[model samples]
Target: MSEARNTFGKTSITQKSKKLQPRVDLTAMVSVSFLLIVFFMLSSFLSRSNAMDFGMPDKRHIDCGTEPYCLGEDRLYTVLVGINKIVCYEGNRLDFSNETRSFKFNDNLLIKEMISKNQFLKNFYGDKKGLIVIIKPSKESNYGNLVDVLDEMAIVKVPTYAVVDITPEEEKLLADK
Candidate 1:
């Protein structure tokens, strides 16, 4: 709200028009501003994205009385994530001779490789649950790299995958490269 008012002054022979000061009431504006702020805050908070559900391996060891649970070497795949490059191999050991292959994040080579390997494993094992992927992220890698690898696993439709800590030997290998 706004208004103008005139004040009385001494009278003189020459008459002059007096200037009035304008007054504005801001109570309604303040209230509306606060309401808008609260509405936006609540809306943003309510619409926030939920965290992704990630499964972690259980630490407790299960005992098989007479039999040992073992996964075949060919079924296991290891992926090591570094700064901008990814190193992958089949089985637990990182063999530089012929098994290890490195890829960059910008390309689709890694995804294609994983899909082919997964398909091969499925056909060779004659079962849907044959491939097991183990992801090991190095210290130089960022969180986005890990998440990208996880996304790759999902894209490849891998049934079983675990995010494990990188071994010292593996770290040394990466450093030497």
Candidate 2:
């Protein structure tokens, strides 16, 4: 917006001068702004978001003692997710009695335990593949527990892992606890 003012300062009768008004053109500014918007819109990429790497095992390779050297109880680490509690076991079995331990979620006892176990196994066996985690979410568990266990697995850097269903014996043991 602009205003024009005309001034008459001691003008002579024979000589008179016309006052000129300044004009500002908004067309160039508007066009430049529009062009910039168009450029940004065209330069932007519209693509799908990346998914988290869950590291799912291949079904074709899974063998429950159908082949030799299959994943056994000692090499496998089972993480049972429950309401505000976590139960972890290491072995080739899911009997829920051998080497089973429980921890509350508040102190991240599960992750700390997992880290210690991984470190111990790494130092003892000298093999990263020695620690395979089998995440078993019981009926008492929720999605948050599952997610937390997975996050802990990532933090602990477990080499092999999977999410499996709970067995009846395991459910009975969980109820007893």
Candidate 3:
């Protein structure tokens, strides 16, 4: 004879059958993934469209570099654009006492002077490419002032430019002057 078995809960051991329910709420997951995709697309677009702005000189490639590795060579005339004053330096030295002294950016005369001087430099050097303006702002200068100087440089159509900070050596030289 067959034997009867007892189960934890139910009418009888073999009376009820077990059933499994399939579960999958994919709607929330799909919504989240879609939102993530949209967010990333927008973020990437914004980042790609942002302007590439640089501040200060890139010391690694240009500043403190050696020989031909340094920025602004003999082929380019170097113009120093400072917030309070714009001075021109050549051969990495500013000699005010020399007969060929530096020019200051003041009123409209400075721009005119720059044009004539740049013309002379281009004629002599045979590189009419454009001037190389090195922008240096004094520590006490405001950002707006620096921007104004940059605007003037832009108006003059500088080919390319770099920024230089007043190093301890440069400051001492200026102080001695």
Clashing residue pairs in candidate 3 (N, C-alpha, C atoms within 3 angstroms): none
Candidate 1 local lDDT, 91-160, one digit each (tens): 8766555367788899899889888888888888777666788899999999999999999888888889
TM-score of 3: 0.50
Of models 1 and 3, which has the larger lDDT?
A: 1
Ten-residue stretch with the least lDDT total in model 3: 97-106
Which window of 10 residues has the lowest lDDT sum in candidate 1? 61-70
Best by lDDT: 1
The 0-to-1 C-alpha lDDT of every candidate, in the order given, reads 0.82, 0.74, 0.57
- The residue pairs in collision within model 1 are none
Assess the local accuracy of residue 166 in candidate 1 as a C-alpha lDDT between 0 and 100: 92
lDDT value for model 3? 0.57
Q: Report the lDDT tens digits of candidate 3 across residue range 92-125.
A: 4444542222444456655665566566667876
Candidate 1 residues lying further than 4 Å off, grouped into runs, are 1-51, 60-69, 95-98
Give a tens-digit lDDT track for model 2, residues 70-172: 7555667777777777776776466536877888777777777777877887888887455788887898788888888888888888887888777777776
